[model samples]
Target: MRIEHLAFNVTAPFEMADWYVAHLGMQIVKRGETGCFLSDKSGMLLELYEDAAAPALDGFSFPPATFHLAFAVDEVENLLRALVKGGGRQEGTLRTLPSGDRLAFVRDPWGFPLQLVSRAGATP
Candidate 1:
């Protein structure tokens, strides 16, 4: 069986959903009183909602090493700058591997870590 959407318990589903759409290029599949479902350009699903009965997964508890949403980027530096300008915080220094892959980390407004990756040939 294949996995479906990944879900997150957030304080503000509506606002966080909007933020992801604005900054991460996600499209809202559906939004309702319960929560918001978002899809990447490729149609990978992510659900954001508030659940008073569930534990929250903010960056403080999860931390970058625990988990992060990664995305392929044409230019890590450029997208890194955009993420910060869009209210994300720089989590660490940019790194270029011997294989020529570029990697950068940042945290969203709610403190979720995001990894921007540029494979060796993915970027000029």
Candidate 2:
């Protein structure tokens, strides 16, 4: 089966949800007091849950670093420019992989890392 949903522990899910919807064009498909489920036009989900007041997972109080969520873009340049206009900071310059894929990074207001990528040979 394919991966369906992913969740990130966040400070304020409502505010963060709004930011994702605005910045990445994801839609708020569902929301609750402490969590939200967001979806793209294709119906993929990205969930966010409140966790600041809760104890750490596995007794570690550090931030989550297992993996980061990436938002693929048809045009990395346009996405980066829009993110910059929306107050997000560019993490680094676009890099072309040996396989010819292009990728770049940016950071959200709350410091979550996001990647924008275009597959090799795809029209930008």
Candidate 3:
């Protein structure tokens, strides 16, 4: 079966959800006591929830290099800059792959890794 959604356990899910909606252009599909469900522009769902009994994962402790959510963007540098200006942090310098794809890395305010990529061909 194909994937329907992915879930994230966060400490401040409500505020985090707000940030995502504001900066990432996500829309709220539903809201619950623990958290909310968000949909990306293409309608993929992201479940952001809180579990008080479990500690939220810290990006530093978990190392974002091992995992990140990548988004296909039209302007990597522009969106990367906007994300940082909105509260995210830039990770490193942007790079252009030999295939001509452009990439930039950044982290949310709470420190979830996000990759902004502008594909070169056939996938935009």
RMSD of 2: 3.9
Rank candidates, lDDT, best first: 3, 1, 2
Lowest summed lDDT across 10 adjacent residues in model 3 is found at 56-65
Q: How close is each model in CA RMSD to the real structure?
A: 1.8, 3.9, 1.3
Per-residue lDDT of 114 in model 3: 89
Please give, for residues 1-124, the per-residue lDDT of candidate 1 as tens digits: 6668999888888888999889888999999787999998777899998888987777766667679989888888988999899899998799999999989889989888889999987642
lDDT of 2 by residue, 1-124 (tens): 9779987777767877898899899999888888899997778898888877674223123232333467767888888899888877777688888998888877776767777888886642
lDDT by residue (tens digit), candidate 3, 24-114: 8888999999999999878889999999798876765555568888888889989998999999999888999999999988999999998
Name the regions of candidate 1 deviating beyond 4 angstroms: none
Number of clashes in model 2? 0
Ranking by TM-score: 3, 1, 2
Q: Give the lowest summed-lDDT range of ten residues in model 2.
A: 56-65
- Per-residue lDDT, model 2, residue 35, is 89
